[model samples]
Target: MNIDLRVIGEAFHQFLINIGLTSGQASLIDWIFGALILLVIFIVLAILLIWFERKLAGRVQDRLGPNRVGPFGLIQPIADTLKLFTKEDITPAGADRITFNLAPTLAVFSIVMAFAVIPFADKVIGTDINVGVVYLMAFASVSSMSLLMAGWASNNKYALLGGFRVVAQLMSYEIPMAFAMLLPVLLAGTMRMNGLVEAQGQFFGLGWNIWIMPAAFIIYLTTALAEGERAPFDLLEAESEIVAGYNIEYSGLKFAWFYLAFFMNTWVLSAVATTLFLGGWQGPFVSQVPALGVVYFLGKTIIMFVIFAWIRATFPRLRIDQMMSFCWKVLVPMVLVLFLLTAIILKLGLPTIAVWLLILLSNVAVFVIALWLLGKGLEKSKWASKRLFTPEIPRL
Candidate 1:
């Protein structure tokens, strides 16, 4: 049988016509394909992050991490997934069974939903919503609600305390986080992730947003870590104090969901950090190539992930009081000052000298103020302890 190329091409065209797909509809098909690709990327990234975290933690603690599972432990996450799936699910006696079952899923769901608004690259965004940043913040708050549900449903006092601590900590940091985020939005003039990335690209020849607005960058990094509930700010799950915190009672697949959510949350935060401060997806000599922006985006996200891991490995967890005080007393003030300085710079159209001078002054002032506050807090703590320990005459 002779194969006619023109006949085959005509048959394919007829098939497209049969399915109500014009060339324009083909574009929609391409978009859907792009989205599926992004979903795959997300899954791969999540698994990679888990493996990276384990290896990093192992190295830090002087142990081999997951070396037995697959070559170089590359398949450890897959093994862990199979194990969690086959394990028996347990609901504690006297637990609110419905919410108990739903809580972990909700936590995972909220994080995945937040990813919808994030732009992975110029053309690879899932949904380019105008209120993308706000959407992210909203879903992040939902994580707190999930923790609350998990805690309350378990009927455990420790879980409740952990839930309360998480909610309180998230609330305290959210204000400063929002304010710090505003500086970037002010500079970028839009809340969309693509717009933010584009704004960064516009200034690519100058520098990354981190260097242009160092104070805001610092505030953003600190607030992001706090919001992410990473180490130092991760009192929500302080195992030594609260015995696994809000997820103490969860097990099997449910527990796995919570764990997956934590990984996903960190991944999204890294992506957001990459988008906002780094020249997201805008690399030197890369954007010139068509469709290579995703490479740059992934690179930035991975770098941010490494930074997150480094901080987690390096810093000791902050106490609850210290966490709250640091966010409100230190970060909020610094963010507020940064916002003001950014506003003035924008309005006055100042030269580089003026901008650098303002940044220097702001940093110096913040350092001095933080030092003074720490000194006062220490003195108060000592005096209060002294009075509490003082021998009292029998006033009774």
Candidate 2:
């Protein structure tokens, strides 16, 4: 018998066929059902990720995280949800009532829409389009506007400042992120996400984009941290400077939405990195046991998230000048050079293995040189003295 690897969309269509539905009708139903499933899955995953981050942070700090709540404090997120629900939704006195309210909704909507093109497992995807990569990048850009709305509508100086910071910060990093993503598309010759993963299946466990394009992977991950506004790059809510930043005036469920969207974007970006660079759901025996594709995919996602949280725990927030400098001066040049190298290598018309090996070696060289340049720059930087004083501050 032929192997059965069809995902929910195909399986549902087959079921509808047996039940006498027309092909168009079955396809439409499949789409509707798949969309609902994805929405519900991310919503629940977002809840659990909140608790996961807390527990991980607790461990990193030598403490038990939320042991008093449901098993391993899994129910803590639900309880927190209940608490937020019971609190009054307070709008600031001078805030634009309409934009203030709509901002949170738009923030979450932008991220949730990106999931529509993500391929969770073999044959399991929300939608496949020729330009799936472009679609994801476009949708991800929309959330920046929501942050601006939240900041401007609040009428708070700090909030407005934070909004301006977001516009500068997010826009600066997007260029490098897009350039880093370009290598994978050039290699696969397809913007389709599933095709990206399938291209790496030939070598099983070893055939991964990260293996060949390590420089792009590094650039992508570093830029992703900035893009998602997670630690070091989390200037949007740099507590000491702005006291909660753009969402300072928001409270109750509205505030909850802002925070939740923050984490969900982190979650989504991690998943995207795994799909685009790592082997995604491909693994040894994955083809024979198709369900294992979901397992491998999720496992990679969790590993990626752990690295994200670890960075949050370890790094200090950067100053505005330093943040902008790193993007425009450091990351942008790095991705540009990597992109040019990829093009030149492809133009040489080398054999497949030779091309991958050359790219891998070139990536390793770039990473080492970038580190050397950073160290030299830091020694000459005026902020060196300030960083030396950072150790005097107490930690919780």
Name the candidate that leads on TM-score. 2
List model 1 lDDT by residue over 279-394, tens digit each.
77787665555246777888888888888888988899887777777787778877787777667767876775566566557656665677688788867774346447656689
Score candidate 1 by TM-score against the native.
0.85
lDDT of 2 by residue, 1-396 (tens): 224556445777999988999999898888888889889988889888999999999999899998778888999999999999999988988989999999999998998898888788887788778898888789877899999999999999999999889878999999999988888999889999899989888766567999998889988999889988999899888888888889999899999999988899998888889888998889878877777888888889899999999999889888999989888888888888788888899789999889999889888887888889988998988768666754566778
lDDT values, one for every candidate: 0.79, 0.88
lDDT of 2: 0.88
Which portions of model 2 miss their true places by more than 4 Å?
A: 1-8, 14-23, 385-396
How much lDDT does candidate 1 score? 0.79
lDDT of 2 at 112: 86
After superposition on all C-alphas, the RMSD of every candidate to the true structure, in Å, is 7.4, 2.4
